[model samples]
Target: MSRVILFNKPYDVLSQFTDRNSPSPRATLSDYVQVPHVYPAGRLDRDSEGLLLLTDDGRLQARIADPKFKAPKTYLVQVEGIPDDNALAALRGGVSLKDGPTRPAEVERIDDPALWPRDPPIRVRLSIPDSWLRLTIREGRNRQVRRMTAAVGHPTLRLIRWRIADWTLADIAPGRWRDA
Candidate 1:
């Protein structure tokens, strides 16, 4: 049987096992996961947080990471400004990106989620209002969620991947991992 690991990837931690570019040491998967022969199924940017799946089976990893598989990835996004109906509709309909038009997304305004605080908090602007959004998309484009929100005139301030298909971040804390 294949070993599946669910990790709560913390902010500023690289998705890879090693950080070769930086002369100074940077946080990476090796710092958290000690399980041998396992590799991340997909990547989460260093600035992003929450659920990341790892597996020893190449086929299983492909199933989760490949965009053609259309695995739904959900995010709890904090944007710089309050989004209105038009903006929400644009997201639901699929916003045009530089690469191409994205697939339609399931999006809704939501209250801030109950989550652990980051070591360094996201910047706040007193004058500009912020709002939370629950967004679900099928495609795993690079930085797609962040870019989508920006295209809709609301740049994402903080992003957390809450779910991927049936798996979720429930019971997982930042920098922690568990067999799933």
Candidate 2:
């Protein structure tokens, strides 16, 4: 049987197992995991935090990573400004980023009750308030969520991926891994 590993990756950790020459020396997967053959199904940027899937089976990895499969990945985003109906609608309808136009996503404002504190908290501007948003997308483009939010004029202050398909970051702390 194929095995899947769910990892709650912390901020500033490299998704890969090795980073021989990183300047600031952020944590890598090798620091927390011992699984030999498993590899990350998809990548989250070093700045982003949350659930990441790893698998021993190459086919399973491809299935999860392929855009054609349209696996829904959800994120809890903290933005610099509260988004209005028009901005929310634009995100749901799709926005054009620098790379290309994104597909329509499931976007909404959310009252998050289980958010964790980051090691280095996001910068605060006393005048500009921060708001949380839930963004769900089927495609896994590079830095897509951050770019999309910027396109809509609400830059992402912090981003935490909450779910990927049926899997979630429930009860898992940062830098922790569990068998799925």
Candidate 3:
């Protein structure tokens, strides 16, 4: 049987088990995940927080991590400004990024989610308005959600992956993991 672990990666924690290059100790999966022989199926940037899947089975890992599988990943993003309808439409129709045009995504504006407070809260400008977005994409590019929001003129201030395919962050607290 495959050993699958669902981890709620906290901000600034590396997806991998070790950080051999850094002189100072950095938080990593090893800090939270004690399960041996399991490796992260995909990666989450150090700045981002959310659900990450790890598996002992290479094939299951590939299915979850590979963009070719088209598994949808959903994010709750807080952006610098309110995105207008045109911006939402642009995202839905697919925006041209430096890499290339992205696949059309399911995008919608949403009310602020009741989430745990970030240790170092996001910066806020008193004069500038911010808003939340629920975005689902099948592609997993490097900092794709952040880049996609920035492309539509609303830079992302905070990002959290809420769901990846059938798995979700659900009740998992930051820096915790559970067997799935």
**CA RMSD for every model?**
0.6, 1.1, 0.7
In model 3, where do residues sit more than 4 Å from their true spots? Answer: none
How good is model 3 by TM-score? 0.98
User: How do all models score by TM-score?
Assistant: 0.98, 0.96, 0.98
Ranking by TM-score: 1, 3, 2
Count of steric clashes across candidates, in order: 0, 0, 0
Instruction: Report the lDDT tens digits of candidate 2 across residue range 76-165.
Output: 999989999999999999999877889999999988557789989889999999899999999989999999998888999889998999
User: What is the C-alpha lDDT profile of model 3 across 23-131, one tens digit per residue?
Assistant: 9989999999898899999999999999999999999999999999999999999999899999999999988999999999999999999999997899999999999
Writing each residue's lDDT as its tens digit, candidate 1 over 1-180 gives: 999999999999999998889999999999999989999999999999999999999999999999999999999999999999999999999999999999999999999888899879999999999999999999988999999999999999999999999999999989999999
The lowest-lDDT stretch of 10 consecutive residues in candidate 1 is 111-120
Of candidates 2 and 1, the better by lDDT: 1
Once superposed on the true structure, which residue ranges of model 1 sit more than 4 Å away at CA?
Answer: none
lDDT of 1: 0.96
lDDT, each prediction? 0.96, 0.92, 0.95
Task: Name the TM-score of candidate 2.
Answer: 0.96
